[model samples]
Target: MTAPASSAPPLPDPAPYQGAPERHPRRPRHPLDTATDPEAVELTAPVFGPADVDALDADLTRQHSGEPLGERLTVTGRVLDRAGRPVRGQLVEIWQANASGRYAHRRDRNPAPLDPHFTGVGRCLTDGDGRYAFTTVKPGAYPLPGAGAWRPAHIHFSFFGTALTQRLVTQMYFPGDPLLPYDPVLAAVPDPAARRRLIAAYDHQLSLAGGALGYRWDVVLGGPAATWAEEGRR
Candidate 1:
């Protein structure tokens, strides 16, 4: 005879069948969605004028009483949008290690000498043609603390749009830095062409007759050819 249904209580009817637990379709991601993008965050714009920056601010070498040591360089570049339009009146800023490859910050333990004459910081507003220039010394390469690697000579650049949040940051490397291949920071950029974009081109025309060597690096804000930003991929 068929055994009486086993004494185990009927599986509590699956708690009244909560019908497939309400599935909501995920919203499609927009190609241009910046909601979660840190680089797209909106920031308050501060009012700035010519008086805000001293005329001497663009010249890093003359910041101090005497000239800094090392090879003086004249770096000039244009800031453009993806469409190749000038980003006029935008603020362009740069800071880098001194000729000895040592930062002015106290935390830098690179054991390299610091330049009292060179603060390694400069800023200028882009002209109507989106050009910005700086006169600084060539930064030396320095070894990373624990990475067993060295950083090539490079200048850190910051571009400020209408709002502080609209800033984009990149580095300008010398045309021929052997250390570029080993630098983890530069290597992080997977694309070779994009990597090359970070290297400034030598420009003899911009070089001073008896003074600074010249390098030109054009910054493309957003596009297929956009300069690679340090914070994130564009």
Candidate 2:
């Protein structure tokens, strides 16, 4: 005799196989594992209008009634991206010690005389061609607190995009500075080529008639030849 099929609602469709739970859930990875990584964290751009920056802000020497004590300098440069394209309309700021190697800050106990007329700070926006210039004095080398070696004569540069988080800080050194060899901060950069990029070149074309000496330094935001940032690559 043939056996009849059991009904039992067709065995409940085999209970839809449930796979095992992930033994080790994969950890999230950062966008920038390496410099070449294509992924990047998007940052909001800062908003700045013409009224935000005063025309006089670009001239540090004229901030006070009298001129600051130091060798007058006309520092000019273009801000560029990795592709060598101009980064127009960005804000560039600079602050440094006076010619005597003394900072205007209260905590700076370098013992050097401070120039009453010099505030040692300036800022300007990049032009359409990405060029920005400042009229100021060359900063003097200052000794690091408790450290035997002295810091090289360099101007502290701060570049800002749309936001404060987009700010990139670095120091610009003059060419042929003897202190360059001993500056621990500059030495922290492992690459020789990258260190050289920090030094500005003398530009006679940009020099003032008999006033400030001119220097040209172009900042590269990223790429193989990008400028060496103080905090590291951004």
Candidate 3:
């Protein structure tokens, strides 16, 4: 008798997590007021906005070092909206490979230096003013799925939307990466001007005074504030 092949079940489409009150509690008050209130402190949700790239670049550039890039990288950014207002009471999660392009997970085995203290995973709850911080190292540029080429250094971030299902996933690119021109992901932006937004800018404030590079990316989440604010208003 011939054996029959078992068919795999179809994968379900990922649903947009419209964070309803059932899952997340309704805000006691407006996020802005809460953020500004001294007594009513709140954590801001993570949002990637245009200004974030510049802020991140400045932070990293100011803290460069002659030391060998380690497996541990610190990814830090602020959660804000289009209007430049801080959104409080949110969670930020970041994941990236080591300086040698090796992941801590079991599936990765490139043997890059791994920092026991740095698992490439960092989480921070924004302060009452939508500020957040993470202590990681600068990740290394690793090979990609393409013709065995490597991609520029980057860090992945995810946001909690802070209200309803308004989560977002995005990445931050390093400054002056030659691979940016050939990178497929960065190229997807179509418009060169727009694509540049993904690249961080050099800011002196982010520097550690006597360090190699430290990042300070502040991301704006979701569509322009008008739309997202409406959702918040809902």
Candidate 4:
């Protein structure tokens, strides 16, 4: 006679825990890769605090008086890892002044025409391929906050991904900004080479099927060594 067989308990399904404990899948590289590299100086510290999300969103979504925010200029870009793989579903927020170089905020004090219909805030979410797009007017050149009072035309960008601790804050400069030399903030970026990387290139040929000036700017984030190694193959 065959020996009696014992019944064993069923194994727990892992589907529920798949992405629970781990970071978001959008970032292909590990957090270690982004933190250990000497090249990632600016990325070392978390720029935004946990308490900042609400305030940030409020600022980003508020409506401001401005010239009918010029018909939307489509801004498109990608978010990638140090290894250059697309980082999907990252949150991207953008803000800029109206064509008159005046912000909708009361603090702007530029006295320029405020289009009651136009506000500078916009948001976008990266797709699976790490691509993102949003519509906004091209910000005009404005005076910076200082004795020199000079600033180039630019846009502010904020980003967040699966890793809450790795939020980034940066500015995008338009090409051929004559005042770049006079801008203290732009000059403050430590690495001359990395500083140049922040300036966006203008492309007239990127017009949509309808002939809109499309701007493209990509963002690269640092990650763990293991993530960097994995990203290196591609």
Give the number of the best model, judged by TM-score. Answer: 1
What's the residue-level lDDT of 141 in candidate 3?
Answer: 78
Task: Give the TM-score comparing model 4 with the true structure, all chains together.
Answer: 0.63
| lDDT tens digits, residue span 31-62, model 3 | 55654565433235335543443333323223
Ranking by TM-score: 1, 2, 4, 3
Model 2, residue 140: what's the lDDT?
90
Worst 10 residues of 3 by lDDT: 225-234
The residue ranges of model 4 lying beyond 4 angstroms of the native Cα positions read: 1-72, 208-210, 223-234
Of candidates 2 and 1, the better by lDDT: 2
> TM-scores across all candidates?
0.79, 0.78, 0.59, 0.63
Per-residue accuracy of model 1 over 47-138 as CA lDDT, tens digit each: 67778977688988888999899998888989999999999988888989998999999989999987888888899998899998888899
| Predicted candidate 2 versus true structure: per-residue lDDT over 1-234, tens digit per residue | 999864432212222112212322356543444356433333344567778988789999889998788888998889999999999989998999999999899988999999999989989899999999998998998888766778889998999987655788888999978777777777766777888899999988767553679999999998899987855313
Please give, for residues 1-234, the per-residue lDDT of candidate 4 as tens digits: 998763532222212322223433555664455446754645654354434444324332234443355544556778888798998767777777887788879878776787666677776667799987765667777765434456677887777765445567677887666676556656554445666777776666776542556677877777431111111112
Winner by lDDT between candidate 3 and candidate 2: 2
Candidate order, lDDT descending: 2, 1, 4, 3
The per-model lDDT (C-alpha) reads 0.80, 0.81, 0.56, 0.62
RMSD of each: 19.1, 23.1, 13.8, 21.8
What residue pairs clash in candidate 2, if any at all?
Answer: 45-162, 46-162, 46-163
TM-score of 1: 0.79
